[model samples]
Target: MFDLDLWREIFQSINKNKTRAALSGFTVAFAIMLFTILFGIANGLENTFEKFFLTTADNALTIRSGTTSKPYKGLQIGRLITYANKDLDYLKKEFGDKIQYITPKLSRTYQLKYKKRKGEYTITGVSPDHQYLEKAVIIKGRFINERDVKNKDKVIAIGRLVEKDLFVKESALGKYIDLEGVVYKVVGVFSDNGGDEQERTIYTGYTTIQRLYLATDEIGSITIGYNPNMSADQALVLVQEITAKLKSRYDVAPNDQRAVRIGNRILQEKKRLDNMTTGLGILIPIIGFGTLIAGILGISNIMIFIVKERTKEIGIRKALGASPRSIVSIILLESILITAFAGYVGLLIGVGVLEAIGSSIERYWITNPSVKPSIVYTATIVLVIAGAIAGFLPAKKASKIKPIVALRNG
Candidate 1:
């Protein structure tokens, strides 16, 4: 259905009214371009907010023991539940493959000293897995390794703030520091951008605490990190399974929910992500279509003007035996071509602007603001439909033109 003569006529008419046609096309193009930039920035802002919520691993969970709140199976309500090294081992043995990182965690307030500098700070103990689980960034040297944990080395990793306070003008790495009466060598200098609290804590090998300062096998907690993409229901299933196993092993009653507490950081993150998704689901259509409607109306109005200008020509064609369908088809095809061309130009410019913005803001706030190809295809399809609808009324006007009246008016 290619018609060279019809297209030639259409292009000739367009060229004749270049200024007016350009104005109409620019109107449509500007509207679509605005919509694309707005949508991309909105998506980028959402992602930036999500990053603030995730200071640690994206799918992290924590287990801590608590006193019993209710009596079950004839047990006393006031008894305190406890987690030990055995619990950490059992969980790792049973669910190791399902987890990305698992670590035993214990923290105690201690007085730190180096020469004349002295301050009270939190000293945490952990295995090598703590590096990823807590988002620990070791700026110099290395974090605790497997050999350090097994050998119970008296090596420690101090936070940047701690280094500033205790070491003063010298590098803290490979230096000696005193905790109470014991001297432990600093193996690494660490920093965390999360907050001030994260930078106030120090880390040492897990076994160091048990072998030197602590006499008991009991641990403060166990933390687990898993894949973030897992559904809440699936994660809950695993959580419940772990809870049941812990309760059973520790002699706690089956129905007592208060014997232990679980903190699901992943679950919290997933809820936020879902909420953001829902917001986007409602936002895109309202704003995008609102802008598109304005452009569509402009295209419709321009097409009507074009039909009015061609009234005498249409009358002559009808007198020469042109069918009504042919006249309508010509008008519709011209409208479609104009609308489609304008929309494509808008899409190209919009995508370029989004990329420039993304590049400028990638490190500080947003990442990959515009997913270009996805929205491009969607907009292309929308432009076609919009063109059809925009042309319909004008095409009808062209079709209804009586040769006698049109000739007289001309």
Candidate 2:
């Protein structure tokens, strides 16, 4: 299998036509390079989309009340619509198992102080279920439980950044922090993947906020987690039913969009995922055909030309008692070597480019751009196969040429 003289002749042939080999290799390398970069960018975009969606729970939905924009049933336009504790009870009584975790949110800005280090951060009043809705991971202590909510306890769950900001190097757990004028014990410290803004806020019992701030049973918004097993269409229908029923209950106009707005994270995520799938479905074939296949064709065409250029050499070898199979093997081996090496070089260059620019492209919403090795390797194999076919056609013809005819042509 190790034929030294055969390889020596092959290398000698390549050395004699360095320019042709270089040009052929360049075509393949360019195609593979372009192919790799495009796929890498696509993968990066996918990563960004996933990261963006993961900031909130996929099954969570938020319903916020706003001012009525239209007159209905003698109620004037611009009437402020608001949620309350009674609304939460009505939903549970009506929907029951359709709703998983429901929590009323009351948000406010309060001056938080811990030993003179004061900062105005968003203080949101939420129930224990809020932890799952906002994807909060409790790093210390625990979130608000039923006992805390029922008792209207003045305990707070601070975010990681909140603890870091006020507590300095010390832990905020079990420490009392002054909120405006009232001192609330920091019962827990939590982290969120939703970034700094989310991590800067603090959470406490909604009942505590309702009693302390409003002295009433009013809420700003309601967050609901639907049953995960519900289909996307079913979830959407549930949201519509809830919205329509709420508007009717509040005597708001049916067409008024501003009075009640619901945001379904799962719906948004599904649409985005579907669009991404469709886009990739269209894009992959386009890239595969436009770049990789083009490269394979280029390699095939160049191999054909290379065989033609060596027509007289093939003839001379045949005349010197060389077998037809030997002539074909030499040409085929040269084609494979050039295709494989050039394709690999292109792969390396493409990966290097992605690595170099990956961080810089994050602003462009492309994160960790890189191609799968299997894709590049598959493309290379395709190119090598094409090269073999190209060499075979011309090499087959050259092997049949008469010595006289080859000599005359040369």
Candidate 3:
């Protein structure tokens, strides 16, 4: 089925109309380029969102108190609501086995100083499990441990930004810093986050903070890290059950309820981003296929024109004992050759553009935009289908032309 004469004729015909051919090729290439860029952007956004969520926490829940206005079911309004240490103790005593990690935090704003350098930061008094709940990565030294909390040691883990400001050109670990006149030794330095590192924070042991600051038996908030296998809904339900039990035991009204506030918004946002990416993934292929169809149509139109121009040549070949199948094959081959070459060029250009642009747009949510191999393979298949379809109609038409009619036209 490989005819040298057919290939020669197809090549000659395409070479004769280089400008029109180039225009058609450009159309296909441009469409493919647009499709590739769209796919890359969607992919980048999804990756960034995932990274942002991971940097925060994993399978963790947060609890906060909120003011309620209306009295509900015999409960009085305007009550000062708070979740106490006793409530936390009760929850842990009842559901210790079900929980993975728990941290009770007491936060306050204070000026942190080391020698002459001073900056304001949020000072958080947290238990040992706080590091696990927040997924805090210790860049230097070690985070506050159980010994620090148990002994009520005046030790702190500082964020990277705070270390840079308070202890410039020196290791912050083993250095003593003042937190509102209370001396605390820096045990670890954490990574910088969301800019303004010095303005970010430092964490210390809960009992140490309580003892040093003379605020015993009081906590600001509680963060709970549940088992990875547990769903957010399940964690929330457990928190609700714990809250109800605590309220009943304390004889507190529903409006005066001390309840856990689960913070699973990051997970929710991640799921939303994933769904959006999936939709875009489906959409990109449809657009790419549509462009391919248009390119095929252009090839078909050119093939039809080629058939008309070569009518007498085709007729003479037939008259001289050429088979109808051979005549059809020549026309089909020309159309397919043009479409295949143009599609390939388009695909290459599109991929090249993606590679070039992907590097410059790195962010937490939209990093490293690149096309998947599966998508590339699928597009290649589409191009082949387009080439075949583009050639089919023109080949069939050429085969039907009679020698007498074609001769008359010549």
Top of the candidates by lDDT? 2
Q: 36-88 in candidate 3: lDDT tens per residue?
A: 66677777776776667655555666766644455655666655456666767
The runs of at least 3 residues in candidate 1 whose Cα sits more than 4 Å from the true structure, single-residue gaps closed, are 1-26, 278-410
Q: List the residue pairs that clash in candidate 3.
A: 44-366, 48-364, 48-365, 49-365, 62-261, 62-263, 63-261
Query: For every model shown, what is its TM-score relative to the native structure?
Result: 0.70, 0.79, 0.67
TM-score winner between 2 and 3, please give it. Answer: 2
lDDT of 2 at 227: 85
Provide the RMSD of all predictions against the true structure, rounded to 1 decimal: 6.8, 4.1, 5.9
Highest-TM-score candidate: 2
Candidate 2: tens digits of C-alpha lDDT, residues 186-241: 99999999999999989999999988999999998999998888877788899999
lDDT of 1 by residue, 1-410 (tens): 88899899889877987886797678768877877876787677667766765568766789998877777677778788888778878988887676778888989889989999999999888989988887889998988888888888998988889998988788998889999998989999888877778888889877788888788777888888765556666677778888888887766877788887788765766766667767876887688877777776776677667777778888898898888888887777777677678877987898899987787886756766774566755765576567676666666777678898888776
Model 3, which residues run further than 4 Å from truth? 1-12, 23-27, 44-55, 58-60, 66-81, 84-101, 128-136, 180-182, 197-199, 225-252, 255-378, 385-410
Off by over 4 Å in 2: 47-61, 69-79, 89-101, 111-119, 145-154, 174-187, 193-195, 211-217, 225-239, 263-277, 352-369, 392-410
Please estimate how well model 2 matches the true structure, expressed as its whole-model Cα lDDT: 0.88
User: Can you give the lDDT of residue 151 in candidate 2?
Assistant: 98
Residue 304, candidate 1: Cα error in Å is 7.0
Error of 1 at 236 (Å): 2.1
